[model samples]
Target: MLRILFCLLLAAPALAAPPAEGPSPLWGMLQVIFGLLLVLAAIVGIAWLFRRFSMGSMLGRFQPARVVSGVMVGPHERVVIVELAEEWLVLGVTSRNVNLLKTMPKPAGHDAGQPAANPPFAQWLAAAMDKARKRQGDGDK
Candidate 1:
């Protein structure tokens, strides 16, 4: 046992020294960094491919079902209005479950052949402001 201990003490320093045939520290570090960068680039490339291909219908261009509107009632709960098959459905969604609240008919003037006529809020606001300014200018004159 004493001889074995002595041999181990002598061999420890030899084992601790790096092997001369192995890569240098700087080269090993560079390889690790390049490997990590390659992995990162692969991940980003996959994401870009998914986006380019429009995977999982994520672009919202051709969904058969869509959320018309939603309102948050709590941190993890919402009342969502969904449109499906030209019918509107109100749903109560929480973290635990989704419950159907009501089924509503499509609103009047929402003709199947015509797109919705609602203008963007910014455009509507600008028109209203212009009308108000004209009114004020006329009153002042």
Candidate 2:
């Protein structure tokens, strides 16, 4: 057992490449760029597929028949909003279940024509979500 451990430890040193064989910074950067391009291509392909299926476009439209709303009263319980049509969808979002919360009007000085940045309240909501995740993890442990 001692001989086997000694031989294994000695052999492990030979597994790594020599300093001379290491890749240059330029080569590493090129590999990163290549990876990024592949990721962007995949995203574009998925978006194209989404557009082809007209799912995103269809989801933008709200259907009255399937616009039922209710409280999600249990752990992992979720509010589901569905749009019934040729292509149906069920969106499970906690925010949708709690739409009764007061909403402030959009801040002034921000042009309605241009898209607005996320409100400070959004950050607070994110912090609240993080707290919830931590609480859930604590409960599990």
> Which parts of model 1 are misplaced by more than 4 Å?
1-23, 55-60, 69-77, 111-141
TM-score of each: 0.45, 0.28
RMSD of every prediction: 12.3, 20.8
Supply the global lDDT for candidate 2.
Answer: 0.58
Off by over 4 Å in 2: 1-18, 55-141
Residue 141, candidate 2: how far off, in angstroms? 70
Across residues 1-141, which tens digit of lDDT does each residue of candidate 1 receive?
999999999999988968669788999999999999999999999999888888647665767876776766579987676778878887889999999978878787665545443344235445866998999999999
**What's model 1's overall lDDT?**
0.77
**Error of model 2, residue 6, in angstroms:** 15
Best by TM-score: 1
